[model samples]
Target: MSATGTYNKLVPEPTPHSAPYWEGLNRRKLLLQKCRGCGRIRHYPQPMCPSCHSMEVEWVEASGRGVIHSWTITHHAFHPGVREDLPYTLATVDLEEGVRMLAQLRGVPDDKLRIGLPVRVEFETVKDGLTLPYLVPGEPA
Candidate 1:
């Protein structure tokens, strides 16, 4: 990995269904899969809709606004690259679009975290021209 954790770092192995979601992040966008048949939005892109078992789906851009549904503060660095950034918050946020996403909650102290705290999406560029999305406390957009 690069000195600043900018290269050769672990990222999701994108499948064909998930490529668009990952690709969206490169442009600082959050893309979710919406099932045409059931109108359900889902993350971790899939070929078929889990709600309706339909193959018809479309990529939709998320509003990037959400509220913390749950979270945990990690005191241990599970990965070497994140050692310097330890004691970070990992959160499950319920997006305004009705999808829940799990991402690192950035710029928020452990003492400040609470359920239903509004958040917005932010991107962190990683290795191989990819970007990872994180959440930061903010007003709903």
Candidate 2:
């Protein structure tokens, strides 16, 4: 960790195709790629739409609401930088936009976590100029 309370964990390297996604998170907003050809939204931005194989795309803000599709309690940290966050929950969430996102689950207790549990996105700045999204229990907005 740095003096700014930023974690030492590895951060994402933004590419031309995914720059807007990272930029949105830095601005405390969630953004996903919307395929112009198929009118379907997708996460982890790419140059082409997977469904229609079209290069035309646009950026759209996500609602930041989703439900727990699956999760696991991590007793061990794969990276030394995240050792302090051991015993955390990593969840696979099914977003309201029909895309599945994987993020760290926080604020919700283990006993309270279950499939279909509603969650909302919360942004956390882990480093200068970088913010990541996490999930917390809440009603969809």
Candidate 3:
């Protein structure tokens, strides 16, 4: 949590459905839920398909690459623990796989953040069972 200069106040509480995602992050891989019924991908994993209302679902590995669709520079921490790490960037990334994810942005200055900025995922091991995915500026192809 502190490794990237961000506060480690919040740790994800993975549910049964979200366990795969957290587990994948531990291995430095990004995993997203894919609805078999509609061939749609989604984050914040859920039990049924949103597009088709089907119960058939599967897990797929994400490329971990995305473009910043939107972003916000937080000047104050809603959580007290992160108060020291003020002015951090949080972004909504549109993944290459067609789903959007909210993750913290690292290695990118506040002034440089913009829509359509390419980003790639990186993992930080916060604890034994917790590994957080962060966004770093993606390299040019």
Candidate 4:
């Protein structure tokens, strides 16, 4: 959110387990942690798998394709940093890799919003060395 080192928006702080995910986003790729023990993919990276309680983990590139499971339009800003971007859409997307991710939904009008609509991830560089993913209407290529 800060382009000149004065932005006030909160940014993600990567930890040891989540560093790869942040790094992948910087490279414009969406990555998820896959459990080696059970092959279940997960978001919000962690050291252990929730399904199998496995410590074995691997990073895999996600397809970046998903469907809108649900969404809500924010009519008010919860923080001062996002006040200017009022009336934004927050969507819950079910990725093809079997993980659900929540992110800002953009490039679509409110009247056009619907459940089960196709979407894809796109990166936006808010500042140097920092990029984030958001969803937009589209089908996987």
Superposing all C-alpha atoms, what RMSD in Å does each candidate have to the true structure? 2.2, 1.8, 2.6, 1.7
TM-score of each: 0.89, 0.92, 0.89, 0.92
Residue by residue across 1-141, what tens digits does model 3's lDDT show?
445554458777889888998899988889999888988888789988877998777889998888999998889879987787687889999989988999889899888888888999988887666788889999753
Which one wins on lDDT? 4
Global lDDT of each candidate: 0.85, 0.88, 0.85, 0.89
lDDT of 2 by residue, 1-141 (tens): 243865678878899998998999989999989999999898778898878999899888888999999999999889988898888899999999989899999899889988999999999877888888898897845
Q: Could you tell which candidate, 3 or 4, scores higher by TM-score?
A: 4
On TM-score, the candidate that comes out on top is: 2
- Taking all chains together, the TM-score of candidate 4 against the true structure is 0.92
Instruction: Write the residue-wise lDDT of candidate 4 on 17-136 in tens digits.
Output: 999999998999999999999998888798988889998999999989999999999988788888877889999999999889999999999998888899999998888888889998
Which regions of candidate 4 fall more than 4 Å away from where they truly are? 1-5
Error of 3 at 13 (Å): 1.9
List, residue by residue over 8-101, the lDDT tens digit for candidate 1.
Answer: 3456888988898989999999999999999999877879987789988899999999999999888897777678667778899999998899
Candidate 3 positional error at 5, Å: 14
- What are the runs in model 3 whose C-alpha is more than 4 Å off? 3-8
**Of 1 and 3, which scores higher on lDDT?**
3
The residue pairs in collision within model 4 are none
